[model samples]
Target: MTIFASYSIKGGVGKTALAVNLAYALREDGHRTLLIDLDPQCAAAYYFRIKPAAKFKFKEGPKLAGRLRRNIRESDYPGLDVLPSNMAYRNFDIMLDRLKKSRKQLRSILAPLAEEYDSVVLDCPPNLTLLSENIFRVADHLLVPVIPTPLSERTLEQLYQFFKEKKLPPNRIRPFFSMAQKSNRLHREFMAQLRLDYPVFLDTVIPHSVHIERMGQRRRPALDYAPGLAATQAYRKLCLEILKG
Candidate 1:
């Protein structure tokens, strides 16, 4: 199975939205998709109208996989399932820190899931901790949502530098413009400059739109609630670009 992680060192750059919509798009493309919310905020799970259970106990390897399987909830969409996040996940770094081969432990825990899912989309928490290291080691592709702004650009550079220092393969990072305002000159300039700087930036740009903001109210993916909208179409194109790669 292909593991896709929606991640960024900076938050509020449309990362959760990317994960939620990409998972739905993958499901629509005939893949059995599992959206795993690693963020303690649980926004992706909430978007799908799924609630986490009262408690979740952390474990290692097989036990961890079994716990996740038990927690999986079927979404309203046919081929999509969600593993909602727990508040306990806020301590994920501490949990991984106690494990042997900690950086590789997440891959081991998620390995068994390949039998059940064609694609696994992770809604990752924004940070650079031990858990983030584990995610870096586990995910096949790191889909970073970069807003066309100075802070976002700085964070993206920081992410790349982290990968370089850790000797991780930087090729796994696929960044794209998120919440872009076409009429804003700064947005256009940064988008062009970033694309030139980072050749791996995906061609699709998810424009700033009211439809994406309405996801919280609608409690579903924009692809589901506003399929014909430009932002929705951009997500579909982004999904196709990632798949094609």
Candidate 2:
């Protein structure tokens, strides 16, 4: 299986939304997908309508955690499965800070399952913490969602510069525009800059709309719920691009 992470350094950039829907879209195309909600908030589980109870709490006791981990490992969905997140995952950084192999934890957990599915989509947190670092280490591909704004662009530049200075590989760094508004002059200007400065940026761009924001409320991706919408079509095309890559 190919592991792809939907990530952003800034929150509210539509990263998780894209991750959730894109995984569904890939499944619709017949790829077995595992959507890994790596965000500590567990919003991905909420989106999938999974309720956590004391009996199955992922953080409670050793027996329950081990059982759930086995379940996650052996899970079989029709076309997809979810390795859901828990709120206690917020403590992952603090818990693993002194551990030498923290960055490899994610990779170790996933290596055996690498061939079990066609794709594993990780919905990542908004920070470059240890979790994000491990994500970087394991991901075969990274989809970075960049809002068409100065602040967002600055964050993207910072990310690129970070890896460049640290001498990390840049081959998998692909960027696509998000929350774009073609009617706005600023948005248009940024697109112009993106096309000029970043010639390889994906041509497919996600537009700003209530339809996209309503995704979180509906707890489903537009591709699943409103595939006729422009944003859904854009994300579908983005998924196609990812597959082609």
Candidate 3:
């Protein structure tokens, strides 16, 4: 199974939106997809109308995987399941730190689900913590949603630097412009400059749209509620790009 993580050091850059929609898109394409909400906020799970997972005692590898498996809830949409996050997930870093191979423990924890899912999309929490490192180590593709701005650019650079310093595979990072405002000169400029500098950026750009922002109220992917909209089309295109890669 291919593991795709929607992550960023900076939050509010459309990370959860990407994860939620990507998982939906994958299921639409006939893949058995599992959306794992690692964020304690549980926004992804909330969007699917799934409640927060019950708190469970942390354990190593197989035990932890079983606990997570038990928490998996079938989404309203078929072929898509969600493993909602618990408030206790905030201690993931601490729990991972207790492992001998903390950076790689996530791989083992998630390995058991490989047989059941064709794709696993992770809605990761924002920050560069030990848990984030574990995510970096495990995810086949790290889908980073970068807004077209100086701050977002800097954070992307920081992410690359962290990968370099830690000797992680930077190639796994697939960044794309998120909440892009084509009308803004600076946004357009930054998008062009970053694409030129980082050839790895995805060609599909998710536009800043009210449809996307209303996901909280709609509690579903834009593709489901507004499939004809530009943002929804962008997400579908983005999913196709990742699948092609």
lDDT of model 3 at residue 28?
96
Residue-pair clashes per prediction, in order, are 0, 0, 0
TM-scores vs. true structure, each candidate: 0.97, 0.88, 0.98
lDDT of 1 by residue, 1-245 (tens): 99999999888989999999999999999999999999989999999999974486775554766776688899999889999988888988887888888898778878888999999999999899998998898898999999999888789889999999999999999999999999999999999999898989999999999999999999999999899888898999999999999
- What RMSD does model 3 have? 1.0
**Tens-digit lDDT track for model 2 on 215-245?**
7788766777788988778988998987888
1-245: candidate 3 lDDT, tens digit per residue:
99999999998999999999999999999999999999999999999999999888866665787887799999999999999998888989888888898888888878888899999999999999999998999999999999999988899999999999999999999999999999999999999999998999999999999998999999998899999987788999999999899
Q: Which scores greater on TM-score, model 1 or model 2? A: 1
Model 2 ranges with Cα > 4 A deviation: 52-68, 71-77
| Per-residue error (Å), model 2, residue 114 | 2.0
Using lDDT as the measure, which candidate wins?
Answer: 3
TM-score of 2: 0.88
Q: Per-residue error at 70 for model 2, in Å?
A: 3.9
TM-score of 3: 0.98
